[model samples]
Target: MCNFKLSSSPSSLLVSTTKNHFLISPQPSSSSSMDPQPHDDGLHRWPTPQEALEEIKAIGKISGPTAITGLLMYSRAMISMLFLGYLGELELAGGSLSIGFANITGYSVISGLAMGMEPICGQAYGSKQMRLLGLTLQRTVLLLLSTSVPISFIWLNMKRILLWFGQDQEIAAAAHTFILFSVPDLFFLSLLHPLRIYLRAQGITFPLALCSAGSLLLHVPLNFLLVGYFRLGISGVAMAMVWTNLNLCLLLCLFIYFSGVYRDSWVGPTSDCLGGWSSLLALAIPSCISVCLEWWWYELMIMLCGVLVNPRATIASMGILIQTTSLVYVFPSALSSGVSTRVGNELGAGRPARARKSMIVSLFCAAGLGVAAMLFATAMRHRWGRFFTGDEEILRLTAVALPIAGACELGNCPQTTGCGVLRGSARPRIGANINLGSFYLVGMPVAVVLGFGLQMGFAGLWLGLLAAQASCTVFMLRALTTTDWTLQAERAKQLTAATNNQSSPPYPPFDKQSKAAAAAKVASETFCSGDTARDGCSIEMEPFIIIVKN
Candidate 1:
């Protein structure tokens, strides 16, 4: 309901960021050598403070709801762990290990894969390519289902894998049990992630937050029955997750079916989806690499803690500590998703400078929120662990790690938001390159040496994570600063128009009359004489599609 339309008033259109820059997209001249006709305005300029505030509100309107949705989802995981903590140290430790494995291998993978939708769906909605949205969703679902097969195999074999890695045998067995039951949640997430992106791109986040909240509210009681009453322990926690995810997925699907606001995009599934598969795959693969690299680094750090001195206390404490970081992280992640939607939409709408403005606002917001998270976590370090467990040792360990988690978040918030900017600009590969360098090339070596070689243990691992985040932040800042805004705007227009050329109607207002005018206008134009053609001109082709299309 907080959704703010970009042009709040007719006067605002000129006073603020107007859609004017894109009003007269030149019809491509039929000549093969024709160049895109230049417009009076090449790109939008930065908005005034009042205009920036309105657009920032537009971003936050999406962010506020998605942030709540993320919080609900985060709470579901933390509650399950909180319940496990109450059960005993063994269940907590086992649940922690199983969760780490599932996140690194399953949820993170699916999440990263789903990010492929941000650009496609966001740009489609921005460009008003309504039909492309539904087709993109179909293609995404197909790809996610295909990827889940191998991940499922790995989850089913997690116990053996953990044991092979010399994990505590009992913890390994319990972790395996938890992951086995959690496999169904993986498929649900595949559907959920795509839906989340599609809806957010349209600035429809209230329903998603509503649905997730209801299910997450139900999740608490379900966890109570499974873990507290049935005594299913960590496996029971996994069952609760499956149900919670299914509830959210089903509700969003139902909304899309009945709301009719998004119905224009859904013409039912079709083979037309196959056409976009390669493009989606191209975006998806890099997105997965970028996101998973960062997600896996942290989860791996937790797994490494399993081999440290007093493994049970360290792992159990991390189970809670990781949840804490995840809780605070939702704010930045939501900002990233929010800005991705805004930027992609703007780019799709052929407003590159508008996208640039949104990115700047998001970075400032992330920085302020990150600083707040740091201070809160630091202030609560000594007392915060009591919220999860009564074990004095677990509490002590968690307290020591909380400060480090807090500091890591400062770098992480902006880096995460920066990735969103890259995704919206259709440059996921840059993020992948940066992540590969920061986490794997630099962060991992530091973590390994400090955690084991230097015998610094848990603190050393946190330091490693901190260093990786800082490195990533530096790269993202450079990417943001160095990008060419005008070129990106041109690319945005081409991609949007190109997509509409293949898929008709809802993607563009170039309906019958507009089409007739465009065709007739081009049909009236002519190539220069053959002698003049030598200067730089070509004959028009039939149907009159401008070859040098803008």
Candidate 2:
């Protein structure tokens, strides 16, 4: 009989053994997991220059492809807009209105809801809890698909809803026609959103970029065939959008199948997915609120612009500026996704210090990107509007508004990145509350005061946006700065371990073949390290399991 005792710091791994069985648990390390228990000379120090560079490299690997994917996705929307513009102002206005409605009601909801799985999947991957990752993906997809039903119904009644809101009848009818055709998009996104997060969590982003690029290559051609040659008009535009998404989904499935990325995790749908939704909902609802609040604000600003002194010029300028901010948004959005993955992965692996460092590096990177965006916006202010319109008033107003929008980007980038940090740490409720306060409570009143009360006109409305971004940035940075990484890491472990009440045991049960393989791998890695005590082991922790050597 072999008996062993284990002890370690709160952040360090522990090991115990009994009757020829070894158990390993998470512990702090100096270098990497392979060199656990090295000297801790600078345990809590800020990352060194070299370490910072390495972190930058790691973040770039994730953010680079993520940015490309984002740009490609943005281009799809742009292409659709261009097609609408070509059809005439009525078609463009109606299509744009319908798109805004869809975003607020459909796309945003699905996106935010699906994001609930990010922290879970990312942390699970880091903790080597492969089964939890797959199960979470399935559960999220089920939740999104269920969510799409009501959203589809809302889209079906788009004309009624818009008419009730006092919109022009002809525009409302056209909007309805477009949205009616877009209903299938809701279900397709229900699946695509989860799959993207599923792969993103595992740092498999290059494939996403590749798939998005492929879909985009087909997007223009499809739009041409549908909207132009086929003479389907607005309906055709909607169909092309839906088919493009469906094509992307098919491409992702093919890639996953051919690459066998699902081998380690996917186990097919089970009864487990039917019941364990509480864990997902906890994160999903707040995430939905956070995303929707931000998205709705922009749409709200567009509405507010409708009441300005010169409605045509102000509203048109607002649209162009909105597009400008959105374009600048691509980089920070990618950075946010990257940092979320980094922080979640590090914490899941029980490396609190590394997680903190990742957050720091991400913030710095966001700041730099923000500066660059600001400068570019300022320099291109005079030229950007020409690409959209030649209307002297709209162009004049756009040039005046571009600089302010640039300033907004300066704050927006960091706050956006900070939101990702919060999400990665499973604190989206905090981000939601902060957004509510900053946008509604703080920003909205100022916009009303300046734009209406003080009569600053369009610029005043933008100033309100600046105020919101500033407050959001401050609060977001405060939240990130005060995070407790160790506690977050512990929480990650618990989250991945506890799937649901009716689910299988805390740790996924392994089959005989897998058990043998895991045991062999553990033995090869740990026993050969010369780091195990005579009766104990220094093996890395699995979320929960116990194995006996043969």
Candidate 3:
């Protein structure tokens, strides 16, 4: 009879077989583990063509489906809006107000706070700290659920708040009604955000795309059933919106159960998740602010338009242009999420060069996408407005603003992707500072001057955005250029190291003398193999870890 033994660590696994008194242990390839890539020439040198191509493929695999998934999710909101339109003008107006309010207060906050999990989950998976992934997910879900409570109270008082702000009584009451029905969405989103990040961190994307697409396909029919057939009115529209997120969450849960893809990382909920709030909140607050600062800027623009010379036309045209930018934003946003995962993974794996390469490749891709967006907006300028309206004044204003908005995209895409790089590097606070400085300090001043002081009107408001994007791009590029990939890799190691220590080791820790001996042996082997000159194979490499069984 033969005996078998198995052992694993972050980097590799050992499988042993024995017959009689003989034993053979085989190890997996280094490339398949957390081992650094062979090249350790540092981050300055450009990646070889093969490396660049591989990085592109990796990023594309995540970004392609991610882009589709984003569009599908965005379409859910569009469908809701369309159904509201079908209900009549009053319902449309009220629903639009409520949706916008929810976005600013509820959805944006949820999305931003959830981003705090990205770097942690990505790095945890990369470093093979599988338990940390589950812990992070659970902690994030708990955090978001807690956050939703206060937001719920805010939603509960929506009418009084809207009325206090001097909004029309009828519209405020309508908005309150719509918002009241949407409270359930806050809880659903709490679960959905962490779940998506948990999967995406592990290079799981197709399922997200698949699930989102399936949900969106059902969204329209569900809307019809509730609003048209049940005649639930605006309440039906709100409920349909809530139900879409709930459906997506359920689908994702079912998919995970059926596929068992989460088995490796998911240790199931545990008491370990109860702590670790501060670490997550540190990242989450800045991420939330960074996202909100950008989102609220556009909303601020809308408010500014309302006070313009021709309020109706300006606000209408602004709405159309905002929609145009939203459409253009989808690709860059996807690229951002993809790069964040890639960077975090490489860094966590202690492959600084590979992480740097991911950043470079993603930046170039974002630039290309930005240029394409600019050209598209420019090319479609004459006719793009017709999709939303045929009023000559609004159309003309939209046509003029479209190209400027496109120019903004030229800067927007790269900056957005750069933000992702920052997130992956666990430096969201830096991105937040940049946004706060650029948009509010620089862009806002420029807008006020151009729009009112110089009397450039609506176009001036867009030019302000152009100024903001340009400044933001400059700063983002500077940040990316100045990044210390080696330092980031060290940080990633530290971040996951704590969690690994908290976990039960598969085997006992090595004694001091044994660890020193093992280190010496590994160093000698690496040096003799002509890897001594490389940064990774030096004596200061990671401590040797192993598991053995008799």
Over the stretch 287-378, how does candidate 1's per-residue lDDT look in tens digits? Answer: 88877887777677766887899997887787677778777778787788788888887777766666777887788888888798889989
Q: What is the TM-score of each candidate against the true structure?
A: 0.80, 0.85, 0.85
The lDDT for every candidate, in the order shown, is 0.72, 0.77, 0.77
Model 2 misplaced stretches (Cα beyond 4 Å): 1-43, 500-550
lDDT of 3: 0.77
lDDT of 2 by residue, 414-500 (tens): 888888887787667777888888899999999999999999989898899999999989877776766656556666766666563
lDDT of 3 by residue, 1-550 (tens): 0000001112211222332211111111136322256346747688677777777877877777788887887778778888898999888888988988988998889989999888888888777788888888888999899999999999999999999999998888889999999999999999998998887887777778878988888889889999999999999999988888898999999877766656666766667787556557767887899888888898899999999987989888998887777767888888898889988888777788878888988888888998999999999999988888889999988988889999998889999998899888777777887788789999999999999999999999999989998998887887778766776776676556644443322334446565556445434422211211222221112211211122
